[model samples]
Target chain A: MKLGRHAFGDDEALMMAIVNRTPDSFFDKGATWAEDAAFARVAEVVAQGAEIVDIGGIKAAPGVEISAAEEKARVVDFVARVRDSYPGLVISVDTWRAEVGAAVCAAGADVLNDAWGGADPELVDVAAEYDAAIICTHTGGVTPRTRPYRIDYDDVVAAAIADTVAYASRALSAGVARESIVIDPAHDFGKNTFHSLEITRRLDEMVATGWPVLVSLSNKDFVGETLGREVGDRLLGTLAATSVCALAGARIYRVHQVPETRQTVDMVWSIAGRRPPLRAIRGLQ
Target chain B: MKALVPGTLALLPSYASIEDPVAPLRAACLDAVGRLGPRVRIVSSAATGGSGARVGAALVAAGGGTVVESGETGVLVVGNGSATRTEKAPGHLDERAAAFDEALRASFAGVDLELAEELWADAACLRDLPPLADAEVLYDDAPYGVQYWVAVWA
Candidate 1:
């Protein structure tokens, strides 16, 4: 997959670390709200071998409205600074606003991670204009920052596949490079706990669609509901889900913990015969 | 012309790791195999399973050589020393392993077959080959607690 300045092999599994710029983001909760703190987070994940840094200006959950101006203010300069500092790092901005997407792209962002499932129709145009990658996601037609209350589907996996594929088609029609487009089943955005779990179980169907799958199964509500663990205690559950996705051939992982997720995916990738052991001399000596 | 290489299963592609543990050994084996010309015969130590034959074929194929049944241009022999060389070796440190390897290294033509079998040494094919006193030794070491040698005689 090509992310603007970088191209990854088909056999590679990439780690996209979450770097939230929001003061009230659920996981970090004002930890990286300061620009310096967020920059430090970028450096830390980079050092931890993350290939991508997903910088988000607004929290996923509902809160006081953040205008596009505020979102651009939060991420544009930070993305520029990170771009200048780490030219090899894939910079992705997690926003649903075309204005924010274009602004960040101008500031050297490589990917527009539309976590709200293409809420802004022009986001794809912005991606094509800037020659940036776009993550087409399935959010069940819900508005941005809204929780999934009373959201039901005949088959959640089918809905996710249909929506994400349609969104991918839209991105393709908008002239987004085929290699730069990625599909995501936006877990917990328009999905309840059970829907997210079902999506995880049937993730291979999404993978079978032939669009590279990006899974944001980080410290989300689904893992919390499954293990009854709070936000800070969901690393193990997230990695377990990540292993399932990796086995099913998810290409990109949007994660909070890079090292743990990388180990899990590498282990599963090797088991699936897609990757070789790093240094295997145990019995073949 | 003829060459000898270790019967290391790690040389096979199926047993390959991302970081090859036997890179230098592989390089030596390939270099020796390349010198065996285009049409060569493989004289592997093991009569059953064909492990040595597989390694020979792979190395020959990689060196742009073909295996021929008769009228061969060169010979590729596959054999190795004892697996019980060190305390952490695969055979768990047999006391006679070092001396057995030393004897075979000096000359494999007159090895004691019963003692070689007891030490888990793969030298049956090497026993029939001539001495390596005048041959060019490409590699000689035991990186993985098991001794390996790559040599060529033109």
Candidate 2:
């Protein structure tokens, strides 16, 4: 997949490495929380096989609370540094605020990965204003960590599918091209494991919606339960899960272990093959 | 599929209490993976934590994983559909119940180990795990374990 027509193309699956610059983030602890370390990791991921890098200032993750201004600052510092580190790299800022989105785009972010399904209209405005490619997420039936209510859904796949389509429609209306828009069926965002497994098992169906997809299933508990391993020992599980995502039709993968996941994608692509099917049905009769 | 270190599996009673390791660990484990990057897969730390050396020893005994206390979130923040939920028990039962029962019942040869508790939602509150301060557990009978899904075709 080539982002923004700069001749930047991923030969196989494009791995989007995460560079979160936040204090309360569950992962990273203190490792790569620093600007220099974040910058270095970005380079390493690219060198390892990441086609793109996603840097977020504030943790947009569930149960996290951040004011817009603070979000902007968090994104600005690391994104700015990373942007400077690699002029040719495809950098993205994971923010839903239009202001922060705009600031990051101006600061050198190439894409906007919004987890809010564009619920923040300003985010769409920012994408349009900045002329940056956007990744519109559909967090169907997600259970917000901070909110006081519990989330319940009867048809998770259907709901998520609808959410993405609806959100994409909004993005299209906002001037995001069909090709430039990518959809993510937010796993763990709200759905339970049953729903998550159902979605994953039926991944091809999710891909059929006529848009590129961004999958973030790294080191997550889903893979952990499968292997009965601990959170710290999820490397191989992360790789396998990423492989499944790639095999299922994910164009972009947001990951923690960049090099290894990239390599895994390459290996699977060779074995699984991403060849477009023969078009006998469309051939001149 | 090795679990992501510090990754959360399901919201178990062990980690469920507002003040317990289950709730907080869920957040912390997610962060660990977020920090560890995508290569590390996560498992349910609700049972993995609070067990202290037992959890670490189990992980070490299982031979190829690390263990830690999960915080308030998960790396994937999945819908619990992607994971394997166990019967509701405090963060103490996951692996213990299985082997505990397995050892006692394997001798019977025909008997299957009974699950300690049915997995549940926040609303179930079957066990005596503390509640999340002002928070409610929502669907009490929600099965344990949920997965954070990847992108798929529509």
Reference-based TM-score of each model: 0.98, 0.59
Residue lDDT tens for model 2, B1-154: 1122222222222222223324433443333333433232222324323332333233232343343345322221111211223433333225443443333222222222133223211111112212223222222121233211111111
The segments of candidate 2 whose C-alpha lies over 4 angstroms from its true place after superposition are A5-11, A60-64, A141-150, A275-285, B1-154
Query: Chain B TM-score, candidate 2?
Result: 0.20
lDDT string, candidate 2, A126-239, tens digits:
776666778877665333233213556777667777888787788778876656677888666665566666667777777888777888777766666778887678898777
A174: Cα error in model 2, Å: 0.6
In candidate 2 the C-alpha lDDT for residue A37 amounts to 78
TM-score of chain B of 1: 0.95
For model 1, which pairs clash? none
Worst 10 residues of 2 chain B by lDDT: B120-129
Predicted structure 1, TM vs. truth: 0.98
